[model samples]
Target: MRIAYLILCHGQPAQIRRLVMALPPSSPIFIHVDARTSAAVHAEIHQLAYLRAHIHFVPRHRCFWSGYGIVKATNQLIISALASGEAFDRATLLSGADYPIKSQEHINAFFENAGDAEFIEAFPLHAPNRWSNHEGLYHGASRVDWFHVRFRSRAWRSPWRRRLPLGYEPWGGGQWWTLTRPALELIADVARKHPALPRFFRNVFLPDESYFQTLLGNSRFRGAIAGDDLRLVIWDRPEPPYPAILKARDIECLAESDKLFARKFDLYRNPEIYELIDARFLRRS
Candidate 1:
């Protein structure tokens, strides 16, 4: 089974190169380095990927954390990957900060067995026009219930209190996902069929998390979603900036998590973790 990887990242070209090298060699990788990245780093990212076959770089977007730009960048990658004419069995959306924690063979086998089951997390985001059993625990209720606007030198929130456009029961989830071709196609189709969809999400805070989730949750593919992204990301850490950077101390967790990949690692802070995973998980037969 073929897996197409769509990666979105702003920095850490070296580590991203490592991520590319670790994936199944024949799997197509479509990457988007944020447009706001330094010229040097951008050049370095392209140069580092120069020799990699089936690794395509798409148009970049100036991505901001918790902004709609991230979703745009991800969509660019997805569009490029799909346009490649490859019949990918699965498309795993990742960041350059992510690395596979499983062997390439195991990774391929997992997707082969996974079939059309989408690995994404989508919870019914409690909104004014929606009612959900997932209310008390949902933290992004405001994402859909309130309007958020971000522009150059301007950031504002609240106002325009409206229900989810087009009768969608708003759904929210982690941005990362591994989905089937049909799921991604459905999302693309929905966006094209309803131009207002993207515009609605463009004003929502962190559209990357809600946009796709809501689309799939409201589509025919809803029953097929597995409700898990399958990446071992640590969120409840006692620190700022999370999906806490994976350190050497997290290596044991990575190994034991039985996950296909893990995210947000920094070679600068914990180079040994990369070495350790390369030596054991990555390089292992």
Candidate 2:
């Protein structure tokens, strides 16, 4: 089965190249580099893609952490991949820092057995998480109109609130996922049909985490969801802004997990971890 990889990356060309090469060459790779990325990094990514037949670079978006830009970049990658008219069985969203824990053949075989299930981790927005205290307020609040809601600013001092459009419920989850083509098309259709949804979410805190989850959860594909993003991420604290940077000591734990990918690796700090993974799991060394 053909799989399309939608990678949202900003920097680290070497790491991205390793990820792309680790996957099956037949898999179409659609990369969206952050608009703020350095020209040198962009050139490096371009060179890598130029040498590969199926790897292509799409338009870049100015992505900011925990901002609407994340959702924008992700949307662009998914839309571009679908528009390419590729007959892909599934589309997996990944980041530059992530590496595969399973070989390409194993990943493909796992998906082939997965049938049409969607692999997304999600929960209701009001599910008693530490991210928000006034979860119900999100229902009738225009997160965009609020002041200083983007980035590291607090959400407590919002100016005003507006109700979400009818027939929409708030949902949130981790940003990465593996989805069937129909599930992705459904999300794109929802965004296309409800232009206001995007505008409203543009101001919401970490919209990337909530937008796709809310749409997929409310749609008919909810039943197809596997409820797991299939990525093994380690957090230093229960509610940390970023995941812990993986290292050599984590290789065995990563291998033991059934997860397909692990994230937040730094070549400068833990190049050996990746080499070990490649030798033990990916068999590319």
Candidate 3:
């Protein structure tokens, strides 16, 4: 089975190159570097080996850690990968800082057995309209316009905040996903036909965590496997903006999780993570 690995890098082109080199040559790689990043780093990325032909430099935009830009970027990557007309069985989205925990052979074997089962966990979301108050959970003149407006400021509960016939449910995890071709095609079709939904979601807080999850959950592929493929991550002592970086000491956890990937690691803080996973998890070239 072929896999299209997509990574979103906000910084550190060197680390991205290293990770890309570790994967098998047959596996296609696609990257979306944040458009707002430094010009030097962006240039350095395109210069990396095997990248000139596959890389996609998405428009630089301010990505909100808790907003919709993240989702928008992911969708763009998926579309680009499919448009390549390559023989790809699945698509996996990752971060610049993440590392795979399994060998290429093992990963290929795993997907060979996983068919028709979507690995994404999805759910529904409903919330009250809050437009009456100056500061509302959502601000807009009407329900249709609420998702379109830029959230400038949240008043102390706006007049528009009102309960609707909706209740938000749990969506998918924020990081790491492998979607089948059928699923990807479905999402692409939905995205084109319903432009407003995606735009509306883009205005929502943490749309990455909601947009795809909501669509898949409401689609015909809802009954598939929710989560599998071992991926290890250590959150901060109390958990900060990202998960805890994996260190040499965490190598044992990485070996034991049986996951395909683990995340939220920084190469600068713990360069050993690279060596550790390369030597212990993946085969030496």
Candidate 4:
């Protein structure tokens, strides 16, 4: 079965090229480079002849951290891959700077074991039951607002909701995910059937976290999920909104997670992380 790598980035070309070279040539790559980024970024993508055919430049738009754009960009990627008609077996969505922490051999083996199941690790995030106390939040907070207050809930928003074949679950975690073709199709179908759904979800807090999780959890294929979004990221001092940059000290822990990937490595301070990954995890030539 084929595996496709999808990365969304607003970074330098040399860095992205280095990442492209790190993966197998046969594995398809799709990138959504924010158009508003500098020209050098686009040029770098062109330099990587390997990704030229698979590269997809999404329409340039300002992505709100808690808005619909993130999901829209992802949906665009899914549509592009399906339209490519390549019949891939699995798909992994990654960020521009995120790197894989597992060897290709291990990654392939994991997917082999998880056939037909969607690998979108998630945790329970109850709503109103937990959010009702917040001063600004309303009794009927839209799913979008959970992005900011999910961790503070006092009780399950509703456990029975999670029991349905298509139940609701809290959606907050790393944006990366590995989806089988069937799961991808399921997501696409939902997007198609409900024209207003994407817009409806765009306003939700942390929609990226919930949009996929809630949709899949409420689908007939919910049972097929692997239940963990696998990636290691350390938050910066004071716990900034973005994750901390990876470093040498974090390498050993990341290597041991046995998860498929780790993310947010510092391009400068963590070149060694890349080297360590190349030498240990992926064994890139």
Candidate 5:
């Protein structure tokens, strides 16, 4: 199984290097660095990537927090991975801070047995159990009915409540996912044939969580979706910066989880967690 990895990162050159090195080198890596990344930081990333020709970077997109740019960069990464002349059974999306929790062999075997299933965290917009942070959005009329977070300074609402383009049922969840080739192609095809869907998502609040998700959930592939997202992410802390910056103390929990990858490791605050994860899970037996 030739798995492809799509990574979207803005900073943390060192952490990115470690993540790239840890993955199976036989697989292709398609990365999209933020266009606004400092030249110095980009150079640092480039230097580390020079030796690994299989690790490719797409043209940078100027990303903004909770902005449409996140969706654009993610789209670029997916398109790049598909364009790469490789027939991949799985294409896993990851953040720059994410690290593999399982060994390369374990990950491969899991995907090998995964027959045509799409692993995305998805739920209907009307689901009563929708994520709480989305606040009343689960009850919104549709994706286009919601106002952009930046709609205030010169805010404007549509003349009439707009329905989701192409008749897609609103479905979304955490941005991370691992998709099979069929699911990926369907997403790309929808975007290509029906340009209206992408247009509808452009300025919507956090389109990254909805765009591809809504596309797949409404398709014939819906039944095949696992709804797991295949990632171990946490946000239980009381304070902000959710997806809590994992620490050395959290090792046992993370290691025990069946998730293939874990996210949001803060290299600055506690590098020890990285070493701990590496020694216990990343190192070869």
Candidate 6:
């Protein structure tokens, strides 16, 4: 079965090239480079695309961190991949900073064995102790009325004091996921049918973490979800705003994990980590 890798990238063209080259040539790659990036970066990505057939650069979206722009970009990638008519069985969303921990063959085999299940992390929004406040427990109460707003270059948490529009129970999780083509189509359809969904999530805090999860949790696709995204990410603290950049120290743990990919790597900060991975994981296959 064919797989589509949907990568969202902003910088580090060298790392992006390495990521693309490591994947199996048969898997189509669809990338969305942030529009705010420099021309040189965009040119470098275009050059990379020239080296591989079926590697596409979708329309650029001006992505803002922790904003609806991320969801918009993801939707764009899904649409672009679908429109290509490539017969991809699954679409895996990843950031440019991410790299595979498993060999491409192993990843392919694992998915093939997984059958039709979708790989995503999700949880009920109002589940007790799942959606927590600073006190560390949600106590099974809805947290919908609170709005996260960006004003004057800073984010402010204030009460929107309004309920969700579509009778959807909000859910949240890591945005990165591997979904079936049918699931991706369903998300696109949901977004298309309800213009207000994206508009409503635009003002919510980090909607990328919630938008997809909420949609799938309240739909028939929820039963098909495998409840894990299959990525090894290390968060520095409980509820960290961002995951810690992976380093050489993480190599052994990453190698041992069954997870297919790991995130937040920076070549500038930890070049040796990728080298280690290439030797122990990618090339060894």
Question: What TM-score, over all chains together, does every model reach?
Answer: 0.92, 0.90, 0.82, 0.80, 0.91, 0.92
On residues 191-248, what C-alpha lDDT tens digit does candidate 6 reach at each position? 8999887777877766788889888988999888788999999876453446878889
Better of 1 and 3 by lDDT: 1
In the order shown, what is each candidate's alpha-carbon RMSD? 3.1, 3.2, 5.6, 6.1, 2.6, 2.7
Q: Model 5, range 154-271, lDDT digits (tens) per residue?
A: 3233444556876777787779999988788888888889988888887565678877778988999989878898887777876467878888988999878999899878787878
For model 5, the stretches where C-alpha displacement exceeds 4 angstroms are: 132-144, 149-160
Which residue pairs clash in candidate 1? none
lDDT of 1 by residue, 205-275 (tens): 77888899999988898899898899898888976687798888888899889788898788778888989
Residue-level lDDT of model 3, residues 109-187, one tens digit each, is 9989977777664433333322234233423223222333344322122234322113323244344578998888988
Model 6 C-alpha lDDT versus the unseen true structure: 0.83
Q: Each model's C-alpha lDDT?
A: 0.82, 0.81, 0.68, 0.67, 0.80, 0.83
lDDT of 4: 0.67
Comparing 2 and 4 by TM-score, which wins? 2
Report the lDDT of model 1 for residue 244: 90
lDDT of 2: 0.81
Predicted structure 3: clash tally: 25
